[model samples]
Target: MRWTWIDRFVRLEPGRRATAVKNLSWAEDYFADHFPGYPVMPAPLILEGLAQTGGILVGHVHQYRKNVILAKMTARFHAEAHPGQQITYTVELLDLNEAGARVRGTATVHDKLLAEADIMFAHVGPEQLPAELADPQFVFSGELAHLLRQAESVISASSSSPPSAVTS
Candidate 1:
């Protein structure tokens, strides 16, 4: 089963950038095992959320025709995110090409930086992998597809509305 780390997309500018949000709560399963009294959001999960945001941005550039995989990432954490906080992941496309794409991402809560990451995503064609692993829909299927649709809906709704009616 695939778990979606991000809750929803707040903004998506295809080929340029993407912004997504994940709200942490004490009800999460990880919080139970992470710490009994002081539950902190796991660092890796935070990175995963950022990667998902960046990966969606990269895949959107190719119209989700290629499977975008996280190749490498370097991240630094400035503060711990707690259960009641909302994490906003903003990723900017640094570079893009046929082989791969690179993005710079930041996780923030209430305008304060919690973490930052530089992520690289590689695009792999069906022919480049084993048959079992080469499902064309592998990357953009299921939950991930749902997130993309939500992003498109937000983008479409915003574009059709007046500037004064739009609020971020």
Candidate 2:
């Protein structure tokens, strides 16, 4: 079964950055018997959310041809998330190339940082996402590719130097 986790995206972007929101609740199956009376959102799950957001950014930037995979992470949890709390995750790419992309992101609740990480993704074609996700009819991929191209255009324009040579 496709993990329902991917469906929880509240904010997703194809390029530049992506935001994801996860609402902690008692209804979650994982919380049911995790700790009985002292339940909390699992740390690993929080990291995955952040990773997913970053992965989406990388995949879109490369047009999904460079299969992006989570290569590594350096994550630190600063606070505990409780039931009913909403976690907002934002990821921004620091650098990107043919081989991989580096991103830094945070998950917060009420302006408090719950977790932060520097995540990396290695690029490969069709390997970044399963075949089911590679379909052209997929709305997310199409929308993301458009946005990513727009962002690239802006960056290219900003980086070009104005006419340098002077006419006689």
Candidate 3:
């Protein structure tokens, strides 16, 4: 499915990090039977969201090349995210190399921490996985690429803006 989760939640923050937003709503498909009256976003899915966000960051750091897969994660869920909440997931790169990279991230609803994780990934060549899995060009092209490029452009312009001169 090309992991539409990334497009649905993630926003690249140019040279700093990537921030993803997940809007929980009663209309979500999973809410039908997910605790019926007391529903919450599943912890596993929240981890998946973190992984996707960090994966996108690693992918961009590699200039959209290489197949990157989550190798490890130490994640904790501190609070339940309920319907009508806007969860902001942010990932910051801790280190990067030819092999892969490490990222630290947190998911929050307003000031309440929903989850946090330290994610690690392995960067492999296109031959390391299924043709579909390894080809990022195919995965990110079309609409997703257009949106990401737009985000990237906006980040670039924002970064290039000069600091205002202070009154002497």
- Candidate with top TM-score is 1
lDDT of all predictions: 0.86, 0.68, 0.70
- Tens digit per residue, CA lDDT, model 1, 56-144: 98887767888999999999999999999999999988888788988999999989999999999999888788877646669888767
* Pick by TM-score: 1 or 3, better one: 1
The residue-level lDDT of candidate 1 at 135 comes to 61
Q: For candidate 2, give the lDDT of residue 168.
A: 10
Ranking by lDDT: 1, 3, 2
Clashing pairs in 2: 65-125, 66-124, 67-124, 67-125, 67-128
**Better model by TM-score, 1 or 2?**
1
The positional error of residue 162 in candidate 1, measured at the CA in angstroms, is: 22
Deviation of model 3 at 101, angstroms: 0.9
The candidate with the higher lDDT, 1 or 2, is 1
Model 2 lDDT-worst window of ten: 159-168
What are the per-residue Cα lDDT tens digits for candidate 3 across 30-89?
Answer: 777787888888788788877877777777755666666789999887999888988888
